[model samples]
Target chain A: MRFAEAWRVALDALRANRMRSALTMLGVIIGVASVVVLVAIGTGAKREVERQVEGLGSNLLVVVPGRIDIGSAPAVSRLDLADVDAVSRVVGDPSRVAVTVASGETVRAGRRSDFTTVQGVLETTPAVFTRRLGRGSYLTASDVDTSRRVAVLGAAVAGALFGDRDPIGQQVSIAGVRFRVIGVFAPLGQSLGVDRDDEVHIPVTAAHRLYGTQRIDGIAVKAPDRERIDDLGARIVAELTRRHPDTEFSAVTQQQILGVLGDILGVLTGVLAAIAGISLLVGGVGVSNIMLVSVRERTREIGLRKAVGARPRDIGLQFLLEAVLLTSIGGVTGMALGVGAALTADALSPVPAAITWWSLALAFGVSAAVGIVFGVVPAQRAGRLDPVVALRAE
Target chain B: MATPAIEAVDVSRTYQLDGVSVPALRGVTLTVAAGDYVAVIGPSGSGKSTLMHLLGGLDRPTGGRLVLGGREVGSLTPPELATLRNETIGFVFQAFHLLPRTSAVDNVALPLVYRGIGARQRRERAAAVLGRVGLGHRLHHRPNQLSGGEQQRVAIARALVTDPTVLLADEPTGNLDTVNGQAVLALLEELNTESGVALVMVTHDNEVAARARRRITMRDGVVVADSAADDPPADSAAVPDGPAAGGDADPTAGDGTERAEAAR
Candidate 1:
């Protein structure tokens, strides 16, 4: 039979049972919609995590100054200038590497003083953290070596201390010692839950001298490239283990953090997709049920068509096509709804929502395949009907 | 000798109902020749419909050989049988089985569409055939919109659309009044005259049976009479409006030998 004729007949048959066909389509619609929405939400959460991770820079590695044991108290090894120089000379790929000596301290801007977590580092610390200077200068190696009390304020810190005015060359106090603000760091959104622009940075020696602390808390490192990250981390760990065999500190790499987050997101996406998949399975059942009812209702019509020279193949095609049409329509509508929902969520949320073309294609393709798989029984039943008995049926 | 248009040699149909075998037709042998108008007359439950079903290839005979148009009916597959029906035979039913939702023209165009005619040509052919049945004006009317006589006429038009060599009507006028029945009978006669298509009608009406040149009477799945109508008297004779009643004095009357000869 010609496709036009076949399509017309199938359409007519569906239209003949309008309520039943619409109800069947409703199953497909809900199934596709939920799958799309759930997938979008999952993808959105993943994108948010990626942005957070990116804010900290892909090559950045955090070195906490302690071996954290499950049942024992963590040992704090005060990170100091000697440790920073020793590690810098000990590590290979010196050109791509930068280090930081991190600690927390109290500071005051005039009468307004706040206890803020401060990172005391050399000039290269901004590059390691992927932070940029928005105003004055970053700490210099000269300042760190001379133990000068010059500070670079984070964007939030600058805003708190100076308001609308520039805080460069202004005096601020850390541990009751006056320091001059050199530069303001640019905004760096958020890393995990911590606002990146809220901390204050000063030279490592100056921070140690002013706070009367002779040690640094930890060091941060950045590798040149992704391929050398593990190599560099291993070298750092081997060197750290050698230098501080008694102190005990660990070097953490980006891959470990990325892998942990990936696993968590993978499970989250899996759980969400599985729940949505259940609805699709329910939709398939709906298609089967509706088609079964259609086959029963149109038994006489099938017989008549067969008697009138319609082949079994024609009958089968008609029913199968009906299901495909129904589900495909649902798939398309659901994609639109899903994309819409994702966009709406992204607009209203601080976290970003991601919609990919492949995701949309997957949603449609799966629905169509499901329709065909589920429609088979009904189509076969109609095709195999005996004309003698069918024609006799009321 | 030539083959009959339809031939049944010891044909039978049996059904198993609740493990009980009920024979609808039992070893019935009959022949219908080209250009012949034959009526199989019997009451309900007499197996007339069963014989019709067997002859039309709508079903298979449980026993014996059946041939239609010199082709062994049992040799054809279901699809082939459907094709045979589409091309070689047309059916009219007692209830005037027109698709309820379709226009009369569309119902008539069905066979042509099955034959794969283009839509435009199908409509034209259906219109022309409906015109032949005196229903040209009612072509667009649905079954519900048309009167009983009009519906039967549309059914006839549908049957004739395929231009089949044989028309099998199972009580074509069963649902119509006397005037409508006469009108349908007249249309069938006109087709038989104009096209020389063989016509087999099943009816319980003696008045209807009188119109056919030959009549086959059935009882208990057996043929009681395969005879002809009486000749009209020379003066003031009424040439029965349809088939003449009773079986005698008709030129098409059976001669045990001509039954064999008419097969030619």
Candidate 2:
């Protein structure tokens, strides 16, 4: 038989059993939809991590204090202001790096009070951290040199404390000491659940007196050229170890963090996709069962067709086409549903969800393969039927 | 001197039922030429249906050679036999075995489907055949919407759509009432006489059998009588009567004694 005629006949048969066809397609629909939605979420998480890592600035490396092992005992190691200055002197480029001494503190401004993070850094902190002021000017070299009690408020912190009021040049009490707000940072949306716009920035010397802490938490160094980031990171680690003789800190480049995050998210996506594939297997089995039943139900029709002149291969092709039609329709419907779900998730949650064309193509191909693989046995059975016996069947 | 439409020489068929061998046709031999209208008449177990099946290539004989349309039927492969059935012979069953939900046109077009004909050509040919069978106005009506006689006509149309050289029918009017049965018989007679297609019909009813120009009577898987060669009995002389003879024409038309006499 011609393919077009066979297709039309198959479609007619499916339409005759409308409810059964729809029910049979349900399993495949759910399977493909879940696969798409899960992959979208996985991709979304990976993208969010990349964005967060990118937010730190270009060619950036972070040096954080690590635990030191001594005689089989792990001891907490500290990175202080002296170690920061020693590392900077060894690197010999003071303009390319900035150090941050951070602590959580309670701040009060008039009738509003909230706990917020405070970071103490040099006047060049804005350039290194890729931050811009929405209001007043950033801290100047004189402000740091004179031990000035000036602060830069994050966008969220300023909103919380001043609420439509101008925050620049206003005095806010940090750890019970008054500090004048020098600027308000621009709005930077949250990434990975951490709001970047919810902190206050201050000069390093005044932070020491206010919080009574001499230790600097971490230091961020920018490569003079993008290609030198790894070498710069290695030099900082070597210099810090030489200065302290304890190997008490770890220098992590931005690419290292991104690589780790990518590996973890990739595995997560793969695992979710595998789990969703189980449903497709179940759907395939459902298709096989339904096809077997259809063959059994239409035995006399098969006999009639064979008696007229249909070759066994022709009958097999007809059934196979029917199975493929069912699955391809299910695949397309599931794709639409999955894209809608991903879009809905992106709108309702902070994390982004995305559907790629490759996933759609893969899902369609898998569904078609599933139909053919599962449809073979039933089609073969239909093809091998003895016309005499089939005609005799009621 | 074209080849006979069907030739059965000492054809034998056996059935295996629950591990026991039962013979359906015991070395029966017959030949039907093109454009001939032949009917086989017998009781239920006389193997008339089996002989029809063999003629239609629906089953192969266990012994002896059967040829259809100049091809050796027993030697052909399954697909080759299917092609023979499609192009050389057409079948009409007792049940008017039209596909239930399909329209008359599609049901008639079914045979052409296996011939690799496109749908439009198939439909056109099918419509032409249905028109020949006097079903042109009911082309789109499904089988259930048709009367018994009309459905049988559709089946005949399906059988003729491929324009086969022979038509094999097993009890073609067995399921219809008297009026519809006569109508189908009349249509078959017209097809045989006008279209010049060979017709081989299997029927136990003597009146239905007499409608054919020649009759073969069977008993216990063997042809006990053939009316073409020997003169039929006085009561069985109603063969010249038309289908208007209806159901109650003659009571002793195909009695066993007359059949015996006809065989002699």
Q: Candidate 2: give the clashing pairs.
A: none
Which regions in candidate 1 have their CA more than 4 angstroms from the true location? A15-20, A58-86, A90-123, A133-185, A198-219, A225-267, B18-20, B217-264
Best by TM-score: 2
In angstroms, how far off is A25's CA in candidate 1? 2.5
Question: A1-394, model 2: which lDDT tens digit per residue?
Answer: 4677678878988898999999989988988888888889889888888988888787887787673222455334477778777767766777666888778998889989878999888887887778888999888878877879999999999999999999887899998899999899999878657788989899987887777778777888877777877777777788888777865667777788788779889999989988988998898889889989989989988888888988788788888988888888888888889889988999998658878888888888888888899889998999888888877788
Kindly give the stretch of ten consecutive residues in candidate 1 chain B with the minimal lDDT sum.
B248-257
**What is the DockQ (computed on Cα atoms) for candidate 1?**
0.31
The worst-scoring run of ten residues by lDDT in candidate 2 chain A lies at: A67-76
lDDT at A329, model 2: 89
Cα error, candidate 1, residue B11 (Å): 2.5
lDDT of 1 by residue, A1-394 (tens): 3355567777877778788778887777777777777777787787677767876776776666666333577566666667666677755434345555555677789877766777767777766777788987788778977988898888888888778987888999877888999999888866777887888888877766666677766677777677877776666667777767766676676667766777788789779877887888888889888888878887876776666666677778888888777778778887888788778878997646677787788889988988899888899888888777777777
Locate the minimum summed-lDDT window of 10 residues in model 1 chain A.
Answer: A92-101
Residue by residue across B200-245, what tens digits does model 2's lDDT show? 9999889788767788998888888877656545323433333222
